[model samples]
Target: MADFSPPDDNKRTGQRGAEKSGRVADFRYRPPSQSKPQKCGTGSSAKKRGGGKTSIPSPKPQGSAPSHHHRKQAYAALDLGTNNCRLLIARPSGENFTVIDAFSRVVKLGEGLAMSGKLSDDAMDRTLGALKVCAEKLRRRNVHLARSVATEACRRAANGPAFIEHVREETGIVLDIISAEEEARLAVLGCHILLEGGEGPAVIFDIGGGSTELILVEPGGKVPRILDWQSVPWGVVSLTDTVGRCTGSRDERLARYADMRRVVSESFAPFAERIAPRAECEEEIRLLGTSGTVTTLASLHLELPHYDRREVDGLIVRSQAMRDISERLSGMSLEERSQLPCIGNDRADLVVAGCAILDSILDIWPSERLGVADRGIREGILRSLMAADAEGERHRREIRGA
Candidate 1:
């Protein structure tokens, strides 16, 4: 097994005091690109873009046994969000990890949480079914280290802990309902590599289903420092529920989109003010985004017939282009949206809300080009797990020499 050390040197995930002020601890993280993994080429490998089938990479030929080293080092990350259940299983390969298996399902776990403030029975059932499949994949892949996390839906739900217990009892998966601060940190850790090469200050954001996170970053050397971050309780699901749908005539839809943007702007006002001076001081502000909204919009920007992570991931597009797409989508009727190739029915209802949130983000940061990333928390988790294993191995070697 890889002997990576646990990331104890990293800052605490708790948010209070200084953290509450939008400032976080100076955490150190060496990205996989900066450091080589202990073992290379051990294993071989989306979005819960709903209204689609789960994607599983083709496996090795039947009856072919994976190498023992691959089995011992395989790691998995499960991200159970308000709208989706996604899993990634991989092993360290050179500077990065090679994904062996993956699964994604749109469970809509927080479907009615805005009104009910609880995980609905139906939502739970849907999510559990997804998790069952993930469990099977994990077992089949022989995952040696795994981390499962539940986001905003669980954090805000009154019955979240109980549901977590139920999931554990049913599937043997323990979920860590992380803090908003931790969520922001993990996202930055995962996708910062995609930011267009620049040393000037930058902002990276994730527009999630139940919440949106915006992080102001100070970049210099290998690891960027977190200047500030904020998590607003307005994601595609929550925001759509609050703002209502973009229904009726074109004028009405435009009004609804404007309203959504205003709401998000107000929520982001304080953070925007805090970072205003910093943005002004910097020569350039690079922007990167990791979420369904960015990835879907990127696909649209590319005019792909279907969603392709290979083409979308790490792609950069003009900020004006994204805003244009957002406005166009906001004007389209629900049925019109459902017919789009990358959107389909599952994401049609929520994509407008996402657009509104993104538009608001643009108002604040106003970067020229927006870098899109299909990777986020799960990739961050995999890197952390593998890095820890590598660190552990180095320590053991030191002990042997001593």
Candidate 2:
């Protein structure tokens, strides 16, 4: 009932990579240092440079081993979102980092947050237990530098800070409550490589448990520069909590699904309006989504017996197919949806909300295809950490030469 599953043990084969132009190749993670990166802050905010562009230096990807001096340095990134707790541990490879350990669990940390405006005790307990496991992994892996972040749920909860301090006291892991802007930037940094190659600006989104982030980026550098972004307080968990799951007649469920769409659309109105004028003129609109919602839907689109990141991540599905699947999932009853593979009892109830959110996204930015990315904030953090370390190493070399 806790919704906790064992760690993945790197079974996913995190074959993520990036190109010099910030596009995907054989699933890699290209470090931001490969390009001239402007100085930017980390932990709580995104790095914004001149020309109204937000820079999220791509983190180092996982690849070949580094020199002997760099072999011992292991970095970790933990993303504790509203619905899940995920951790990634890796070491800097030649130009990227190789994943050594990873863990993901559906803890639903924001289970009752919408109604209570606070993190419920049960949810906190569940998350803490999962974090304990993450702490153990970090210890066993001997992670040299680690950054753990708590997103929307923690940011919205009144007792979020208290819970964060408690987590440090209990697990010795410091969790930074990052801004929605930073969250959006990090999500893009993690998965932008998967975006379909194109000329015009693209939209990358992360549908979290408590909040959904949509970012518009102009891609031409090592990392795409954010043109505009918005974080709506309507993710799978929050939206589901606000809109009852209409478990009655099929018509009733469809109506509620419409209601969910309406709410999300209105919330996204400002963002939609801002991008419409610019996006409408572009020859082709490129859209990429990184979150459980997109991944789950991608899995269903593939008709796989179970979830597989290798296939889902960096995959593209027809926008119309995604829309049709979202509508279908929205109409299904909780039990009916639960029976479907890739969306069992765990995601049955909340998947509908996700569908609604995705529907709204497709409506605003109508694209021929939607790119799916299983990697996000955690991978972004890993890249940033490795880039910083590489920079520090360069500084040491310069001092030694001087």
Please give the CA lDDT of all the candidate structures.
0.76, 0.77
How well does model 1 score by local distance difference test? 0.76
Rate residue 331 of model 1 by lDDT: 99
- Shift in Å, residue 108, candidate 2: 1.0
lDDT by residue for model 1 over 1-402, one digit each (tens)?
122221112232222222322222212211123333322111110122211212211212223233446435778888999998999888766455677798999889888888777778788888888988987887777677888889999988888888876666566777888877878877877777777886678999999999888888877644467778888888898888767889999999998888888888888888888888767765888889999999999888888899998778868788999999999999999999999989999999999999999999999998888888888888777766666555556566568779
- Which pairs clash inside model 1? 3-389, 3-393, 4-388, 4-389, 4-390, 4-392, 5-388, 5-392, 45-99, 45-100
**Clash count for each candidate, listed in order shown:** 10, 11
Against the correct fold, how does model 1 do in TM-score? Answer: 0.83
Model 1: runs farther than 4 Å from truth? 1-72
Candidate 2 wrong stretches, greater than 4 Å: 1-67
Worst 10 residues of 2 by lDDT: 42-51
Give residue 325's lDDT in candidate 2 (0 to 100).
92
Q: Across residues 14-38, which tens digit of lDDT does each residue of candidate 2 receive?
A: 1112122322111122112334432
TM-score of each: 0.83, 0.84
